[model samples]
Target: MGVDNYKLAMWTFLGSECFFFGSLIGTYMSYRGKSLTGPYPLDVFDPAVTSISTFDLLASSLFMVLAVHYAKAGEINKMLGWVAATMVGGLIFLGFQYYEFSHFVHEGLTLKSNLFGATFYVLTGFHGTHVAVGVLLLGSLAWSAKRGHLANIGETTEVIGLYWHFVDVVWIVIFTLVYLLEYT
Candidate 1:
């Protein structure tokens, strides 16, 4: 059988996303430690709080897996439940990010404050935008499943799953490079 168009499209999109994120990360790495100001990464980063957000994002991947499994099994209600759970996880992670950004601003970090602020916000902000989009997609899937409008639930869920997993993996890299590695 030929590869499904949707699956192929999603893979192509993700390939482009890899390059997009790679450039952001590369820029961040090149600018690391060049900030000659207050609220540098070491002065403002709180890895412990970010760790919770990371865990929430990782847990959403589990929910995505369950969503796909139930969709394949033709269990609409279970699929909806899992999809909603995943969306909730994404929302919670975004909340944590919002709080962190607010705290940083209060601590004197802004996009114009220093190179660290600019690159850090740009990288993580874009990642957060991706997560928000994923949440919206999952929300739409849940709504469609509820209305019995999903024609190919299994294939659709799997496509969404690929995107969700990609976001999670990107966060793992970001968390390691931006948060964890700052200490070392």
Candidate 2:
């Protein structure tokens, strides 16, 4: 058969997501270093912690790839296990984000605190939300696989993997531009 319809739709959705994230990143870049207040990137951003979180997300993408690979091979249990691993990775990334945001707030940086805070929160908050949604989707896939409810496990896994990989790539860009660039 040709490209699966769901995969086609997912690609289209990801195409749109490029523009969505592009805008957020663009805005954040334009407003970078314009905070005009305390709690700047150097002061507030914990690069070491953020790096660990980024690694967690990238590792999840790897697990997602394995899930899809096993799904294509018709190994349902292996696929489910990989999917669960991917979800755990996503959850870990979110946990780091939650801690980072909370620490920023306690240090007096918030969306309303400054231009940096506003754009930073909007960009990264949207990413965190995407990660959360991805985790939920993977969780559902694992649950359905365990219950023997998936009609086409391979296609489902591939489609979700596309989304997961997209999110991971987006985070790479964000991590580079939003976080790493601060030191340059």
Candidate 3:
């Protein structure tokens, strides 16, 4: 009765997400280094800048954890504050991604350019979409919190936190396999 069904549903959704992202990652790996053109991985990937974005996302995860913690403690204002912070972090991450994508397109790496371009865009683009959706969800949660309409703050925060963490984790894997591995 106490969010047991909600928790189960979230877990089921996350289980499917695992497969969804797994296939994308797998496709990216398979197509890595197959792009027979310029603006390739080395020519485009700026790890230093991307590292900053990655750190921001990781920090957002921390904020989400704190938000859930405060929600569980019934501290509505603090939870909302942390949720706002998390949304800002997500926006920053998306900004970085947008800049990167624009730069890539400017540098002549379109989705149809080659295998690398297609796979890279498809994979990271999907991830970016997920982040955008998370931002919207968090924004909605914030609005609900402000309106005093959220009945189960803890459960709500926990469910959204689960999704936020999944997005972060997927980026970690993508950063490692798609970017770091390229350098090595």
Candidate 4:
């Protein structure tokens, strides 16, 4: 058969997401050093913590790959296990983000604090929202699989895997530019 409609739609959606995140990253970069206040990126950012969170997100991509592989092989149990693992990884990353945001606020970095605060929170918060959405999608997939409602597990899992990998790639860019580049 030709390309699936759902997969095509997902690719289109991801293309738009790329532009969306590009604009966000551009805005953040434009205002990177223009903050006229305390708690700048260097002052509040802890690379160590963010590094661990990045690792978690990256690991989730591997889980997503395994999930797709198992789904395609008609191994429902293994696919479900990998899906759950991916969701856990996403959740753990979110937990890290929550803690990091809390620490930033406690350190006086609010959205209204300065240019750095506004751009930083907006970009990273949107990313966290995307991660949460991915987790929910995986969760629904798991529920459907468990209930024997997902008829096309391989195709569905592959589509979701594409989204997950896109999310992970975006994080790599963010981690490099927003986090790692600060020190260089």
Pick by lDDT: which candidate is best? 4
Each prediction's TM-score versus the true structure: 0.98, 0.97, 0.97, 0.98
Model 2 regions more than 4 Å off: none
Off by over 4 Å in 3: 1-3
| Worst-scoring 10-residue span by lDDT in model 2 | 34-43
lDDT of 4 by residue, 124-150 (tens): 999999999999999999999999998
Once superposed on the true structure, which residue ranges of model 4 sit more than 4 Å away at CA?
none
With candidate 1 superimposed using the best TM-score fit, by how many Å does residue 39's alpha carbon deviate from the native?
A: 1.2
| lDDT per residue (tens digit) for residues 1-100 in model 3 | 4646777798899999999999999999988888788678888888877999999999999999999999999999999999999999999999999999
In angstroms, give how far residue 101 of model 1 lies from its true place. 0.1
- Cα lDDT of model 1 by residue, 1-184, tens digit: 5998999999999999999999999999999989888688988888778989999999999999999999999988898889999999999999999999999999999999999999999999999999999999998878888888989999999999999999999999999999889777
lDDT values for all models: 0.93, 0.93, 0.93, 0.94
Model 1 score (lDDT): 0.93
Provide the lDDT at 41 for model 4. Answer: 89
lDDT value for model 4: 0.94
Q: What is the C-alpha lDDT profile of model 2 across 1-184, one tens digit per residue?
A: 5879999999999999999999999999998888888788888999888999999999999999999999999999899889999999999999999999999999999999899999999999999999999999998888898888988999999999999999999999999998888888
Reference-based lDDT, residue 75, model 3: 96
Among residues 3 or more apart in sequence or in different chains, the pairs in candidate 1 whose N, CA or C atoms overlap within 3 Å are none
